[model samples]
Target: MIAIQALRAYNLFYFSLLSVFISFLPVYLSYRAVSPSDIGLLVGIGSFIGILSQPFWGMISDRRKTIKKVILLTLGLSLLVGFVLFQSSELWLLFLLVGGMYFFMLPTDPLTESLNYRVAEQYGIHFGSVRTFGAIGFASASLIIGFTVDQIGMDRLYWVFAVYGVLTYLMCLVIPDAPVSSKRLSAADLRRFLTYPATLRFFLLILLAAIPHRTNDSFLGVYVQSLGGSTGLIGLAWFVAATSEIAFFALLPRFLRTGREIKMIALASAIYVIRYALCAVVSDPMLVIAIQLMHGITFVTFYTASIQYLYRIIPEEWKATGQTVLAVIFFGISGIIGSFAGGWVFQEWGGAALYLMMAGIALLAFLYSILMWKREEREAETLAGEA
Candidate 1:
């Protein structure tokens, strides 16, 4: 029970910190006289480095059997590096510091999820209930900090981030440790894990679906501004999206009991198709904001289902590694591609064209998911017949 509460507190603080960093860091960089191009380069390079770092960190946790230690080490390094980053204006120095921060911060999500899932299982709590606090934190932090940053200056963003970082670290101190295996994964074991059919297929689908989703996330504010929406409207848009996750997450256990994770995932993808397509055609900023309500159906549902699906498929010993792989795929590889490609499309064509392209991608994912679902059903029927 204590562990469950600690996990919830950890998620709340961690995601609150994450919301501040992701939403305001670029603004801080701009305040420091960093050019938009350089900011993009910094973020892109940091994400690329994270691809390698997440898996490495996860492997260390799995091999050393100490997630708490890794969490502490990484968060400590990130805090130190972030402080130093604010003191420098040199492009190269900023690049190095940002890279260091990403290397440390990227692993935190997978590691925390791994720890939380283990703790929830032990405590007989629903993972989604605990995860809902993160959504709440994100929404609340974004709203409060936007007003705070308006009163203060963007230059002071680091102080806010640092305070949350401290709170996150304190929460980490109380999270109960999860069980770890004494046996380490061998090279052959790694290869076999990678070669598994379900693993490969699952990642491929995620990659395809994430490109459009990430593109939308990265540029939704810009899209709103293009429609003449104010900064306040942009914040409202994100707030709506973030808060939308709460109900979905709160109700996730009921769906989990139905044993239809893949079907739910497919339904979420189908919703994405409509969501992005609507964004493509909608001219009103208010309408665009309303469309963000679909985030409840698209991201929240898909994310909840994916976590449950991953937990079911991965071996207990490889849990951290598997989560890290998903992180790397979604945030690292697919993120990079989406950021660059979406920027190009948006530049060359228009916002409508870009969202239409995303809608097309989601449509393909929907079709693929339906096919996979039917195939699995047929296989199940065959086994039952044979029995």
Candidate 2:
């Protein structure tokens, strides 16, 4: 019971800190006089580093059979590097530090999620129930941190991060590590897992779906500002989006039924297309913020379903590594393309054009998801016939 509470608390505080970073970093970079193109490059480079780092740490966790130690190590280093990253104003320094920070920080999320699912299974608790705390933390922190940053100035952003970081680290100290699979992983197992037809197809699908999501994540704050919105409004937008996720996550099991994850992904992808298209047409910043309400619906549906689907397809022994790979695709490879491409588009064609482009990509993802779902249904039917 204590372990369960500790997991919940850790998720809350951890995502609270993450909210500040995700919602404000671009804004902070802009405040520091970094150009949009450069901000994209910095973010892109950081994600590229995340691509390399996530696998390294995931393999370590898998090999050593300890999620807690890796998370603790990464979080400790990230806090230290983040302190310096936030203080630096030079563009080159910013690039250097962002990569260093992301190397440690990016992997922490997947590890926590891997832990969340493991703990949920062990305790016979719903994973979504525990994950709901993270959404709450993100929603609450965005509002509070937005207001606090408005009052205290973006230069002091590090102070807010530090407080949350310390709290999150403390929470981690108490959360028990989840049990690992006793089957030892081999090099052949790793190679075969990566090369598996289903694994490859699923990853391709996630990559398509995540690109637009990551693009929006990289530029939403700047887009709000472009539409003459204040920082507080940016906070409000994220707050609304995240708050909307809580109900969906909490009630997920009620609606998310077995074998529906793929269908849900398709549905979410369709929503993404609509959401981005609507945002493309909106002239008012508040309208854009209003469109953000769709984020909760789209992200929770798409991401949670993807994670659940991953769990179904991956080997139990490779859970950490599989989860980490999912994170890498969502936050790393997609991030690199999204950040760089989004930065370029936002710079050259403006927000409308950028969002329109996103809508088009989302359309592709939606169509592809439909096709994948159909294929899966056919395969299931064939297996049933054999049985």
Candidate 3:
């Protein structure tokens, strides 16, 4: 029970920092006079670096058999690097500093998820129950920070972020360590895992589905500003989005038993089609904020289902690697594409046009999902017949 509480605390603080970073960092960059295209390039470069580093960090955690150590190291590095990042406004310096920060910070999700999933399994707790705290934290922090930033200045964002990072690090110190496998994964093992048909198909789908979502993440605040929304409204939009996930996460366990995780993901992808389309057309900033309610159906469902499905498919020894692989595909490679493309489109056409393009991507993902769902059903029926 104490362990569970610790997990929740860790999640709360971790995601509080993450919310600020993801939802407002671009705003902070803009306040510093960075152009939209440069902002995209900066974010894209960091994500590009993450494509290599996320897996490397996961491999080290797996090989060293110490997830906690890795977590602590990364958090500590983030704090140190972030301090310097906040002190500079120069584009070249920001790029270097932000890249350094992302290298350590980006992998925190998969690493923490790997730990949380294992801990939850061992203790007979639901992963969503533990993860829900993160949503709450994100929502709360986004609102508070947004209001604060509006009242004070974006310059204070760094200090607020640093405070949250400190809280997360302290929480990490108390959480129990997860068990490690005795056997280390090798090149051959990795190759075999990659070669699996389901694994390949899953990542491909993630890449396609992530295009619109990542684009939204990278530029939604900027888009809101363009639509005449203030910093507080941007924060409120993010808060609404994050808060919308709480009910979904709370009810996730009940749905997981239905064996319809893939269908849920497909449904979420379909929701993305509508959400982005609406976003493209909406004229009111408040309405844009209101539409974020769909995040519950889109991101929350997809994320929870993907984590559950990945857990079922991955071997216990390679748990961290599996999570990292998903992260790399969803956030790393897709992030690079989304950031650069979103930047270019935002500069060339506008937010509305960019979102319309995203709608097309979501449509492609939805079609692919239909085919994948049928394939899964066929495989299930074949297995049942043999039984």
Taking every candidate in turn, the Cα RMSD to the unseen true structure, in Å, is 2.3, 0.9, 1.2
Which candidate, 2 or 3, has the higher lDDT? 2
Clashing pairs in 2: none
Model 3 lDDT tens row, 20-127:
778987888988988888889999999999988899999999988889999999889988888678768988899999898779989987899888888888898888
Q: Which residues of candidate 2, in runs, are more than 4 Å off?
A: none
Per TM-score, what order, best first?
A: 2, 3, 1
Q: Which candidate's TM-score is highest?
A: 2
Backbone clashes, candidate 2: 0
Ranking by lDDT: 2, 3, 1
lDDT of 2 by residue, 1-387 (tens): 989999999999999988877888898899998888888999999999999999999999999999999999999999998888877899888888899988999899999999999999999988898999999999999989888988998899999999999999999999999889999888787789889998898999999999999989889989999999988988998898899899889877787876899899999999999999999999899999999888877999888898898888888899999999999999999999999999999999999999999999999999999989999999999999999
Clashes of 1: 0
User: Model 3 compared with the native: what TM-score?
Assistant: 0.98
- Model 1, position 315: C-alpha lDDT score: 70
Candidate that would win on lDDT: 2
In angstroms, give how far residue 187 of model 3 lies from its true place: 2.9
Give the Cα lDDT of each candidate.
0.79, 0.92, 0.89
* Candidate 1 local lDDT, 1-387, one digit each (tens): 667788789889888887766665555565577644455567667778989999999989988888888998988888888777766778888889889877998788778877777777777777887888888888787777766766676566677778888998899888788767666667676677779997788888888788888777667866776788765566677778878888888876776643587798899999999999999999999999999888987887787777778878877678788888888987788767776777667767878998999999999888888877787799889999999
